[model samples]
Target: MSGVTAGVLDEAIKKAAIAWVSVEDGPAYALWCMPAENSIVVVSGPGEQYAPGLAEATRATVRLRGDHGGLILVVDAVVDRLEPGGDEWNELAPQLATKRLNASGTADDLAARWAGSGCAVVRLTPAADSVVGAPDLPADSAAQPPRETPARVETRRPFRLHRVRKR
Candidate 1:
């Protein structure tokens, strides 16, 4: 069952690690992305990542999860919203703050706080020419897949301290 070109969907959206982002009607986010030149730069609001349609979405559906998370590439994007000192935010906010993860700051202080405020930098670009996907509604919840892998330890038994006799 091959055929998923465009360099295997841009090498599975640059070896995914987080990009569940689904919009065109909201809800379905996981952000923390960066792999432009074909688009996939992300970032949302508050504390970081909540992707509620970056100031009027254009279209989206990028799910690229793998590395045990399964689902490898399901793009169909074309959304843009990179305001913050333009020029593609001076070239993708320091490569999306060096593909942040534990960053807390640095990478030019997260491209200067996402070019100084509001935190957006969205850009998906993948609509057709491959990566066929554009159906909608996939903010999946209640996912099940853990039937048990051996690792349980709860012996229980320890709690005795009753003292109150003097009124």
Candidate 2:
């Protein structure tokens, strides 16, 4: 089955975080990460909806997910519960700061940051040119080939035995 795209998964994760923060009344935002690729995408609404809360939550989630492995987060709504400099907001600022500063780095550097946060990173994109053409296989090989027969089978019936003595 086709798996969800990294971008799609990132959007979903952000929406979930927004919902978690009860920012349904505000605008929606999304955050996603390609852990293997050590990449993150942040999308905010046209308005200033869940941008703040979504941003904060996204960072925390990224850090947490990074601990186990890389993750994607999406925030669906905006919440105005806290100011950017407030204690709670400041506490979460580091993550956002990291996101901003590391925004343009190599995947390896991104992976390092994720690892520093005690998480793993990955990239989920299928390698380009992987499906450019049909793969060649040996002519002798068959797809869904027939199964081989067993060498021997046991029977329930018993056979009479004759013994011969050797001098």
Candidate 3:
């Protein structure tokens, strides 16, 4: 890959808080990840962000946004799952837990929970040569309709303060 493409990929992945991953032509799922040693690490499953098929997927498409919040880099990633108590997992899980926003417990606590709770920590190594950026971006928007969900806001009565009228 050229230096320019590499720079774009690095900048996009480092600056974005979330990445959109698609497996087997499925809908892109937005997942939180931490960039590590030229790869992205993501924790998924119950009690974490949903990334169906990613645990077993061998390859995936990863899209990242630029500083302006637009799709900046699209690349193919080689997926590899890490063993729960393996060296790589042990090294990365704590670090990723620390970076997890709105986490309820300490990094060690979360990592331990993940170890026992069937959470999968997968690495996404970008295929540097497959990166698409800049002038090579597709012309049409890739937006998709929202998926169905059971969640909805309930209507409620509003409360207001009562005041005496001046004469």
lDDT of 1 by residue, 2-86 (tens): 2465776767777765777767755566666878776678877766777776647788777776567666557668888887877
C-alpha RMSD in Å of predicted model 1 compared with the true structure: 13.6
Candidate 2 structure quality by residue, lDDT tens digits, 1-167: 02334454443334332222223344322344212122333333232123444433423222212223333222222222224335633443344335434256654444345434433221122222221111221233222434355965667866659765789
- Model 1, TM vs. native: 0.28
Each model's TM-score?
0.28, 0.21, 0.87
Candidate 3 lDDT over residue span 1-167, tens digit each: 53345767777767767899999889999998998878899999889999999999999999998778888778999999989788998899999999999999899999999889998899999998888886787888999988888786678877658865889
Ranking by lDDT: 3, 1, 2
Decide which is better by lDDT, 1 or 3: 3
What CA root-mean-square deviation does each model show from the true structure? 13.6, 21.2, 3.6
lDDT of each: 0.70, 0.32, 0.88
Q: How far in Å is the alpha carbon of 118 misplaced in model 2?
A: 31
Name model 2 segments beyond 4 Å from true. 1-29, 33-81, 101-167
Instruction: Indicate whether candidate 1 or candidate 2 has the larger TM-score.
Output: 1
User: Over the full model, what C-alpha lDDT does candidate 3 score relative to the true structure?
Assistant: 0.88
